[model samples]
Target: MKILHLETSSRNCSVSISEGKTLLSTCEEISESLNQSEKLHRFVEWALEGASLTLRDLDVISLGKGPGSYTGLRIGASAAKGFCFGLELPLVASESIATLAHPFLGKEYDVVIPLIDARRMEVYTAAYDGATGKVLEPTTNKILSENTFEKYQGKKILFVGDGAKKAQELLVQQDSTFLSEVYPSSRYLVDPAVERITLQQFEDVAYFEPFYLKDFHGVKKTK
Candidate 1:
């Protein structure tokens, strides 16, 4: 199956082209000020060209549905939905946090956690079984505290994602480990998206929305 994956859940924006389990091409950029609507399509074209393919060649369009930036998630969802709608293609949605932690799948660990900054010491996170990528602890918004993750203290837990640094500081004095380099990428969506495709788990393109764990509150201006 030929798949095109899009990830714009955070400052790191990325896209990937994959055929079954093999990644054909991937591109990413980390820029806080980027206009996602403009750059996302550009990266999409770049990935397709690099893979020697075109939009019509894609079988499925996958997206990193987020608990990250509000604007980023909207941009990604809009683009993916547009493509699916326009091309009459199926759309698959993968959890943004799961995509961030997916690289650690099958690793030697009791659990894996992916964190996304929720601002002001809070984060959107979930725990997954490292070997099978099963959800060990369901998704939730957690407020950082010194005693966090106490339930998994005796087990080896690998923490990852853009929000891992903030979460790590709170768990550092405990038996937790952190992976600083991990960030959400479209390439990580290939396996899960493919699995969904095999199961015929396509989303309703018109009604799908990014998993925004919390309502977005715009900053107030004070002059």
Candidate 2:
């Protein structure tokens, strides 16, 4: 099946075109500012053109439902639903956090954690089985401390995502590795997405919403 994937869970705005397990085209840009409202559609067109296809050619519209930026998640979800509506295709959602762990699935680690910065020292995160990609610790928000994640200490662990650096600073561990600059992208959003499609797990486009782990709190005015 032909699929189009959209992921804008962080500063990175990404789009990809895939067909049954193979990635055909992917485009992404990580800007200091959140500009998904400006880049998403353009990247979608670019991806479709690069893949030599069109919106009507797509069978499913997949999105990395986020626990990241509120605005970014809104942009991505609106665009995904728009495409599904315009093309009359099925929509499926994948966890944006999982996209962060995809690259390290078969690496030298016993567990993989994807972290998204939340309020202050808190983060939205979960642990995935490093080898099988299974959800080990379910997603939730955690306030970072030196004793954080002590349960998974004996195993070699990889802490990756935009918030990994924070964990590295406090959650001290002997065998943990941190990669803080990493962000979710559509390039790695296709596999689990396709698996969802294969299982016929289409979302209710009318009511689907991005998983915002915490409520949005605007910044205070400096005056």
Candidate 3:
């Protein structure tokens, strides 16, 4: 199956095309100036063009439904919905945390935490059991603090996401493995998206929406 994946849940905007287990193409840009609205379609076009395929040729459209930037999520969802509607393809809504956790799947660790920046020292986070690859109940609202990971002390935790950098200093003393370098990308969504498509796990294109953990709060006006 040919899958086109879109990710715009963080600072980076990315798109990828994959056929079964083989990645055909991927494009990414990390500039804040080039976010979902500005670069998402371009990236998609580039990825498809590079792979010598068109949107109509895709079997499914998948996206990173987020707990990241509200604007970015909206843009991604809008684009995914548009493509799904236009091409009559199934829509797969993959969670941003799951995308962040994609790279570490199959690795053995006590716990895996995928965090996305929620601004003002808060993060949208969820815990996953590395051994079973299952998300734990009650996704968290993690506030950055000096001893944030104290509760998980003695357990080896691997942290990955955009918020990992900020959490690194606070979690320094804990028995933690920081994967601050990993960024959310469409490549991470492809395999899971493909699996979902194969299993017919899809969302209603007309009503599916990105999972924005909270309402958007832009910079306040200064009078």
Candidate 4:
């Protein structure tokens, strides 16, 4: 199952070449800003070149479908669909929060919550069972409050991703652990994407769109 995964849902713009769960190569850049339209193709080419493969050799094109940046998600979706259309390959789409949680699938924590910073106080999040990676709670946008996630108070809840930083003040008082360093990346897209590919759960390249949970709002330029 040779796959090319694109992740542009966050500041970390990444591309990964993988064969099933084994990652062959990855090209990533983490900065304060991301311009996927400008860098996506180059990163993909770099990853493919390093792996000594081309788009034609891939069995599927995977995309990190998101509840992250609107522009970033659009860019990634366009590229994924284009590659699938051109190469006549399948498309496997995985959520950004799920990809963020993939690396913690078998950890000791009872519950794992992956969050992507949406703005000042809100985050896009979903809860998953740590051992099995099963969704205990589906993804949604949440605004932090003092009692947020209090229902799981005594249990070991692991909070991860870029959004965790902003919620730290409140969550720190609860029975929660924070992993502020975890960010979205194509490398983490391998496991879930492989499962989708094996199940033949391919997306319609012609009509597929990323999960942009909210409407995009562009800032009005002021002089």
- Model 4, 38-145: lDDT tens digits are 899999999999999987899889999998999899899988988888899889899888888888879888889898999889999999998888888899999988
For model 4, the superposed segments whose C-alpha errors exceed 4 Å read none
Q: What tens digits encode model 2's per-residue C-alpha lDDT throughout 128-149? A: 9998888998889999998888
Cα lDDT tens digits for candidate 1, 39-112: 99999999999999999999999999988889999999999999999999999999888887777889798789
* Cα-lDDT of candidate 1: 0.88
lDDT of 4: 0.88
- Give the alpha carbon lDDT tens digit for every residue of 41-91 in model 3: 888899999999988889988898877878888889999988988889888
Model 1 worst lDDT window (10 residues): 172-181
Superposition error at 93 for model 2 (Å): 0.3
TM match of model 3 to true structure: 0.89
Candidate 2 stretches greater than 4 Å from native = 220-223
Off by over 4 Å in 1: none
Please tell me which predicted candidate would have the highest lDDT against the true structure. Answer: 2
Model 1, backbone clash pairs (residues 3+ apart or across chains), number:
0
Model 3, stretches more than 4 Å misplaced?
218-223
- lDDT order, best first, reads 2, 4, 1, 3
In the predicted model 3, the residue pairs found to clash are: none
Worst 10-residue lDDT window for candidate 4 reads 167-176
